[model samples]
Target chain A: MRLKCPANFRIVRLPCTGKIDVIHILRAFEKGADGVYVVGCMEGDCHFKSGNFRARKRVEQAAKILDKIGVGGERVKMFNLSSGEGPLFAQYSIEMDKKIKELGPNPVKVALQAKKKAA
Target chain B: MIIASKKPIEEIIQEVKDYKRLLILGCNECVTVCEAGGKKEVEVLASALRMHFIKEGNEKKIDEKTLERQCDHEYLEEIRGIVDNYDAILSLACGVGVQFTAEKYHSTPLIPGVNTCFLGANEQRGMWTERCQACGSCILARTGGICPISRCAKRVMNGPCGGSSKGKCEINKELDCAWQLIVDRLRDLGRLDDYEIVAPIKDWSTERAGGPRKVVREDVQV
Candidate 1:
């Protein structure tokens, strides 16, 4: 099945969602990613027994840290869908793109550009 | 092991805003086990601080390092060469590690990044419960290996105080009564008879009641 996601989004594949770490999510914002979302296997359907659950917890932790640093936790989210749900994957990506547009550019990225201009 | 928790980011930023060059130091021992002040935490904190400074349009240098153990002189020595490079150091160790590091480095200002909580055991990934108070006296033999001093809210030597009900402390229903646990343990060990023996008044001097305490073992000193 051929499906399309917004061009603004880039994908980083991993063996499993459990491979995601808080640092990986935070680094995205540091590198000026306007928003970040993790898509993992549906809850309880993880091939590794609980990898998806672990990924969700890490995602929640990342969101909390982002909120604490005033980066807007809502910019990060975790969604679960089965491997067969190709259409669902495309829909999620589009939804995320719309959400990021409403939030505008990450403040950290905007400040970085301003500093470069001043220099 | 000693358990600690990270301080709020706002509070930390307030304390270090005046400093230009800063180092976020982490301890790889107890703080590491508790997921508070460790190498991973150091990196996360460094990134967060850099972002905060950048978003505020302020220029600041933030560095990160994790030591084997900050409470030991030998481990503290590892950072000696770089200690002076920063205007201030943010230590993510427990209170003991923070003080020890401060003692070793005289000139640089030391800021604590985490609040040292207590001598505790991790119950699960993110749950730590206090276990010992280092009272300088060991009475676990008589209590059937359960400590009332740290576990009991009232610290009553002979108890299941009136505040205890259904094996839970009245202070918090979620908390198990220490004396209740002691009694249960004693019964299981066929030593319920020990429960009837009234304990002597504890010597409070051994605990923190006496100013700061110290231990000396000449044989252990090199």
Candidate 2:
């Protein structure tokens, strides 16, 4: 159960959230992530100005791909928060927990296909 | 880049059901970029197949590795010792990559995980659109840089035929007439008269019809 917690997310902290790329997100899902959500700095508040903007776009692209391949793109999400938004961070986790609960286990796990080679 | 789609999970599982030993191969090239085949995809596929077998009361062992470029000889050579370990190889690369994998490992069965599609461009993030046919010739420069062979339904080099309607192709209402794009581009460059030149019926002699083509560059020789 601990593995499925929002805290189980192996956070790859970046100097700025803008450094996160969509490839990373897709790779995460491919690694069996039940869901992925990028926490980025609030707009107009990014320390790197436009870095957060690029991160947002990357997350969106990853989400679209996840959607296309029947992985439920909603499983991949993005949230904007400031460095000191403790309450918001907690809220995001709680919301993620609920969303994962709704999604249940990963589809790949549920759709495990077995081989039937001759004995 | 060429785009391909992975077969349905059930379909792939069914296709490989008869194999007792399987080697799941991944490619780090085109299919990887298109989100079809890659290290991560191989993991997911392996995990899914394993789970399926266990669920059906039959357990099996599946091995996996990502080749740098299976189409290249050196990379294929890297897997030599273990190639004989598996009865069948599941290739998660494009068609060319799969063919090369089979060529190098003649005794093992090679199965493709992806349905190779046409050459395309990522028009938007996660969205791919076909843009080229590789008809073995070049005509874009004369048609205002838009590929008539690929963009036009009829591959017409003389501009829109009677099928063109209101700057759109009659075949596909959503498609903008390729000739319309050509004329518009020519007009923008103040060279609309360039469209007046009728191209001669293409000499198929220089293309694939001529024979298998090869490029030998002395400077790039190994």
Candidate 3:
């Protein structure tokens, strides 16, 4: 089925959100993702038992790390939803897209662009 | 193991912001297991620093290096060949490793990336509780393996101080009174009589009270 989400929304699926490490989120920001959000299984419903729980904690840590790096923690988020929640997934995508639009391009990318222009 | 927690990224950034070339040093032993100064942490911190500098429109040459164990002179010497390339070193080891690294490279600035918290056991993932204080004494055999020096709020040898109620320390209700734990353990081991014996005054001279100390074994000398 087609994902009814914004064209700019890029989805990288993980077998379980627990596989999403802090480095992954940090790298996304470093690689110019204006915003990054993890959609994990609903609380206590993870197929991998505690994958969602672990993912939530890692996301919280990644958000803090982002905040420390001057990126503002709001740029990274974690959401819990089951696999059957197709509409919710669409909603989250739209919500994240709007959030990024408000935040504008990632500051890191903006700086790189400015540097390129000057060169 | 030596427990540690990462320093606030904001504080770390502030400390090394002026340095263009910085090395993020990680330790592979205790810090790695504690999830503080491990190899993976080096990557996370380095990535965060690089991202921050990119956003600030500054050129930052952040490098990563993970030594087998930063507290050893042999491991620290491995960086000598490349130590001159960086303006600063961000050590993610325990405080011991940071000091040792600094001592080895006296001219280079070595900043601690983690706050060395305690000698403790990881109760579970992400949770650590102090287990030993290195008081230079081992009384576990007589104390039924419950250490008052480290677990006790007051470090009283004969205790369950008047302040202890319901097996908890009065200082903090959450803390289990060290004496209480010792009594229970001794009772379970059928050695309740041991609890009645008063422990002699500890020799504090062997502890930090004696100032910096060292052990040089002539038999082990090469």
Q: Which candidate ranks first by TM-score, i.e. highest?
A: 1
Clashing pairs in 1: none
> For model 3, how does the per-residue alpha-carbon lDDT over B1-222 read when each residue is reduced to its tens digit?
999998988889889999989999999999999999999999999999999898888869999999999989998989999999999999999989999999999999989999999999999988999999898879999999989999998888888779989999998999888898899999999999988888899888877899998989999999
TM-score for chain B of all predictions: 0.98, 0.92, 0.98
The segments of candidate 3 whose C-alpha lies over 4 angstroms from its true place after superposition are A1-3
Least well predicted 10-residue stretch by lDDT in candidate 2 chain B: B50-59
Q: How many backbone overlaps does candidate 2 show?
A: 4
> Which candidate would rank higher by TM-score, 2 or 3?
3
Residue lDDT tens for model 2, B114-187: 89998998888678887887777788778888888789898888978999999999988999888999999999
Off by over 4 Å in 2: A1-119, B205-222
CAPRI-style quality class for the chain A–B interface of candidate 1? high
Model 3 residue pairs with clashes: none
lDDT of 1 by residue, B35-147 (tens): 99999999998998888888887768999999999988898999999988899999999999889999999888999999999999999989999999999898999999999
Ranking by DockQ: 3, 1, 2
Candidate 1: deviation at residue B23, Å? 0.5
Deviation in Å, model 3, residue B68 alpha carbon: 1.1
Assess candidate 2 and give its lDDT: 0.80
TM-score of every candidate: 0.97, 0.68, 0.95
Worst 10 residues of 3 chain B by lDDT: B152-161
